[model samples]
Target chain A: MIIQDEDQLTAAVLAETERAGDPRVREIVRALVRHLHDFAREVRLTEKEFDASLDIVTRLGRLTTPSHNEVRLMAGSLGLSTLVSLMNNGTEDSPTSANLLGPFWRQGSPRMDNGESIVRSPTEGPPLFFTGRIVDTEGNAVAGAEVDVWHASPAGLYENQDPEQAEWNLRGKFFSDAEGVFAFRSIKPSGYPIPTDGPVGDLLAALKRHPFRPAHLHALIYKPGYKTIASQLYSHDDPILETDAQFGVVQRLIGTYERHENEPAPDPDVTEPWYSLEFTFVVEPGEAWLPTPPVSAQRSH
Target chain B: MIIQDEDQLTAAVLAETERAGDPRVREIVRALVRHLHDFAREVRLTEKEFDASLDIVTRLGRLTTPSHNEVRLMAGSLGLSTLVSLMNNGTEDSPTSANLLGPFWRQGSPRMDNGESIVRSPTEGPPLFFTGRIVDTEGNAVAGAEVDVWHASPAGLYENQDPEQAEWNLRGKFFSDAEGVFAFRSIKPSGYPIPTDGPVGDLLAALKRHPFRPAHLHALIYKPGYKTIASQLYSHDDPILETDAQFGVVQRLIGTYERHENEPAPDPDVTEPWYSLEFTFVVEPGEAWLPTPPVSAQRSH
Candidate 1:
């Protein structure tokens, strides 16, 4: 067909997608074409700008590897990841407990009993004892769910990114107990910068925005009868709680870390000024599955 | 600020752009974020799908190199390239002479005088004599413009892609005469399949779409007073004219290839079954600049 104008050209592409046998794919692709064409027209994007944008997209892809995912980072930085998470997991009234799994997640971390610390290496920081409850949307305990947890060290690097840290240094997994409780010990994670060495850094610099994701812990909860969720629980005390670089922060997912100086620590060897965080996760009933780890390989040999 | 919902998340991303110093970039980025979020919402994009998309993006980058650009290819497949081209050039009424530069255009081919041939090596196929005029929107001649011409051989492989072909074979540069006329000779290009061993190939398979672009001659016309248009004069008789894999076929840019069986050839040694094409390019007045060649390497040592 002769594509007479931009609208006609868009329609042609959409028409091609209809030939696909998969209805779901066809629908998603058709909607994508409309929005993409609409976006180009809305901005009156120039040839130079279009070429430059292609370069950016190429670099985002080229910069990604097993140890890092620049494409996913850019998605989070744009808030698309969070928006998708919200739309998929919960209703308008309840909001979603789901959040970005982020680029640091890996598959098959060591599993430990409840209350066992995931802090496997000599990591330095004030100790953080974390407790969490897993429940359904109706507030009933969701026991027996496997919860995989990982977080960045206070130095702003994951075990895969920091060579000094052991393999899976601040990473572990546990199952929710009969009461739907899971606990672990680790140092208080501090607000730190994201990797600014790639195209995403260029974008943040252009937007004049900081690359700090407020201190947060990542969790992926899995149970057969309920939906599995990849989540990040932001620390309420972090100053950038509202401006997380990934935009993964949700109001209800924020955990308040109580600072304690006089009370005895959870681990007898821990010093004063320790902290503790208590939070809960609400999963809905649906298909339960696991995500492929965005960065599966650790840097350690 | 705590981002409460999808709408709020979109707003927060838009809000961050106000900090950008370049209002044009700020505007474009804001629009991009909105459309991206809206696309996600319109499709109710799932976390698994989103993750899969990111994986697609990463492979698009990892597969790109100096000789190949999977990212740009995917954009062309999506029709964003043509949409951007039409949106930036001419009027909604006049349409655009500008088109995709495509992945095979290179930076410095040897320049030649008018009526010369660009077939620098042994190539198979009937001879093709291409003549074109450069004119402004008012139909006035545009003289002294440098025109770069290139096309694939009869075997449907560009010089850069086929190891047996010499560097810059079927590629030449010519300048418009006082009458705005420029012509070059090469083999009649056959429609060719795009490289399909990447994510774009995956997309095409999923869409049940073919990977062939209509046989076309590429031209880049540059003059100081008018816009530098990157164009492809698609063969009107090509089987896939209406279904170009890149979605780059423009209505007015299609050129008729006159076939001669008994007439004298343009060149003495050329056979009876040669083809000839004459077309006029209408350039709109605008800022002039060249594009970075999407692919800039030769496969041969």
Candidate 2:
């Protein structure tokens, strides 16, 4: 084809990819090309602006590391992750919901006994005793399910991000008992801003948007017959619940955090102010699968 | 507003940017967000596919360095650069056309005298004597204009990509004389593939698309009281002209390469078979502006 104009150019490019064997991939590429052309036209993107955009995208990739996934953060900040998660999971009004699997998730978290604390490192804060039950869509408990839980420290940094924290601080995996109940202990988390030294930060600054995510505990539930659910439970009292930077806070995922003053710890070994949260997760019927973690632990091997 | 669904989430993200003081930024961002969300919905982008896309983008950025710009390459491969350039320049059907300001442009190219060769190092190919005139759309010569010209070597590598070549081989800035004429001598370039070790290569491989760009010479013309035009003149007889990897080959930009056998050289330098190309660039009326060069020469001072 003689590619003289944008339309012809687009058609030529699309035609070149018409032989893509994978139907899904072909569909995606076609749609992507069409939308991208439309975007350039709709905005009349200037050459300078286009150059800047290219630099921004390149910087985003360059800033990402094994410990930090800047691309994922950008996607979440742009609401793409949230949108995709909601669309692929249950409908907006359904019970079986999913959430963004943020970049902090690490595979092979140390397996712990139920009711044990995920806080492996010493920390000072009000303790959070969390309990959750995994159930099927029919309201029946799915016993023997595996629940992986993780959260940030009181300083609002994940263990991987904090040098003072232990290797697996506030991360653990446990099997649900016969009653489909799982419990864990960790310090109550506080909202923290996404890393602002990278491209995502620059974008947030340009958009006049806050980078703080609401305090939350992450969980990944897995069972043999039901789809795995990757979710987070937002604190009911979190000040940033209304404005999570990732827009991950959903009504059904909000959990009430009951505060007690100078109450005995759940393990009865010490006395301190503490908080407790309870929530239930509903898993839908589908092929059981686990998503690849956004970030991985640095290997010393 | 609570962001429970894609529409709501998009709105929330867009609303957060409502206070951007720059109207252009706001407009571009709004259109971007809308199109991105629409693309996702239109394709029903799966979570896995989304993750792969993010990784590809990240890899593209990571692969880019001071020596290379893979993100820019990806943009060109997708035809976004060509579309934006065409849209922002003279009408698609007009003569004052623009082309992709590819990533190889280096700032501060050494200025050369009129009718001088840009080849600074030893090179092996039939010598190409290129002459061009810079004029306005009204057919008036744009005297005293600066024309920056560059091209790849016969081996399909830019001077920067090849250590054997001098720092500024096949790159020079020449001022158009009173008659709006400028000339340079260099080796004839050949079509070459873009870097194939990056994510763009993987994408092209998957789409069954070739990554070869037709042989071409690039020129950036600047004059007072005229808009800067970034353009490329393709070899008229190059087999790949119709399928330029960057989709940057336009009909008006293709130049005929005439071969002279044992004829007197344009310059009384040597007796050898040579090629000559003549092209005319049409500049439009606008503020003179220079784009940020995609790549910069490393400074030693």
Candidate 3:
């Protein structure tokens, strides 16, 4: 059909929803058509330019890989990741603020006992003693909640992506004990730059934007019969907290790093002074919680 | 802005385009808005579904790569490649029909003298002799036109991707002699399957579409003071000629392969007697034609 006007074209596309075989696809396509059309209109796109934009998008698809999430990076850079996360996690009343699962989560992380250190190196950075509890919305402890945690090292590389780090270094899964408590010894995460070598970097450069993400620790908490919480605890003082490329910063998700100064401890294990953070995860109760598909499941087109 | 209805959203977006800083960006954005908004209205998209669609597109951006042009494959499957090619090529009449340059063009092909065989395999397939000439619109020889040609092996794999074939096998660059005549010995090109291991494949599977491209040889003709042409010559009898996955089929691009029957003076040097194809390219007079930046240029996004 010759789509002369925007209205006619939109109406035609929306009408396809009724004939769409998959309801999910139909709804998704309709919305996509709207937003895409809206974005174009908002930008007053020309034919040649629209074609060029399509070319850009096409190139993006061709550049994807297991280690590189250019598509996800684009989404995150455009604030779409935050938008999706917000839409999915609408129970904003919950204590923990959700964030985008920034492209580095992998399966098969070794499980660790309570209070086990996730950091493979004891002297990597300022020692951080992190303690957290899993609780229901009503403030009652929820035992057996599994918490998955991971972070980049001082050099700003994930264990999986860095060959120098052993397998699953600085990454571990901890199950909350009877008291619904979990603790792990690790270094404070340093501020780092996102992978800026791909299309996302090109986009950021085009927009005259920076690619730094604020210092933060990644966390995913899950419990039976309760909504799983995917969140990050950002350092309160990190400069990028306000302008995170992924739009992932939330006030509720910020945690304070307390530096314990000059407290003489007799334990030889506590070599030097350290910083600590104590936080609690309050999950919403419900069986209707939306399940997050594993990264691999979502990796395919 | 609260985009309650499609019209208001379109208007809002169009107004925003007026404020766009870059004229090119403004024109492109306007067209994009119109097409995207029209598509949305045509589909009657809902907010919830729109959000999900946004997520999927974002993920697609994260998945881009140099070796894998998944986004291009997706766009091609959706007929976007043909549309872009048509728009770029304009309405000029020409001797050969243009087609999408499928993602396998490699650089630094070995230059061959006229009449040299592009086929390196002695036992690969039936030997075919291809003769071609470059001429102007008035049918006069246009010497010095460089013909770049490459094709898949009998097993339907490009030399670069296949380990068995030596580098630059079944691929060569030959400059037309002073008479504008060029010929090469090669096996008859065979139909090949597009890569089906990525999101592009997933999209095709979702659409219940086959991923076979008809047997064809890719060619790029370059000459000073004339329009450079990038095209493919398809075998007339290929079954998938009508329904190419990328919608790249054009009637004028099909070439007839004539079987050379038993001639008493069998050329012993040419083992496995096969067909012959002779075609000529007519160039349109112009300044040195500049080809579009290759698909790789936009891949870093």
Per-prediction tally of clashes: 0, 0, 52
DockQ for all models:
0.73, 0.62, 0.08
In angstroms, the error of model 1 at B284 is 3.1
Residues forming the 10-long window of minimal summed lDDT in candidate 1 chain B: B292-301
Residue B213 of model 3: what lDDT? 83
Q: All candidates' TM-scores?
A: 0.93, 0.90, 0.57
Highest-lDDT candidate: 1
Residue A252 of model 1: what lDDT?
86
The reply for model 2, stretches above 4 Å from the true place, is A92-95, A117-122, A163-169, A185-187, A259-274, A290-301, B93-95, B106-122, B163-169, B185-187, B260-274, B290-301
Give the CAPRI rating of model 3: incorrect
Query: Which residues of candidate 3, in runs, are more than 4 Å off?
Result: A1-7, A14-17, A264-271, A286-301, B1-301
User: Quick one: RMSD of model 2?
Assistant: 3.2
Question: What lDDT does model 2 reach?
Answer: 0.82
Model 3 alpha-carbon miss at residue A176, Å: 1.6
True contacts kept of each: 0.83, 0.70, 0.09
Model 1 lDDT per residue over B1-301, tens place: 5788776888888878888989998988999999999899888998779988988888888888887788888999999888888888888877558888876777888989888889888887888888899998888899999898888888888888788888889898999999999988887888889989998898899999999988888999999878888998888898898778899888888999899998889787865688899999989888788766553544444
Candidates 2 and 3, the one with greater lDDT:
2
Question: What are the per-residue Cα lDDT tens digits for candidate 3 across B91-154?
Answer: 4443334456676666666799877788665437877888888777777888988888989888
Residue B25 lDDT in candidate 2:
81
> Which segments of candidate 1 are over 4 A away from where they belong?
A106-111, A120-122, A163-169, A264-271, A293-301, B265-271, B293-301
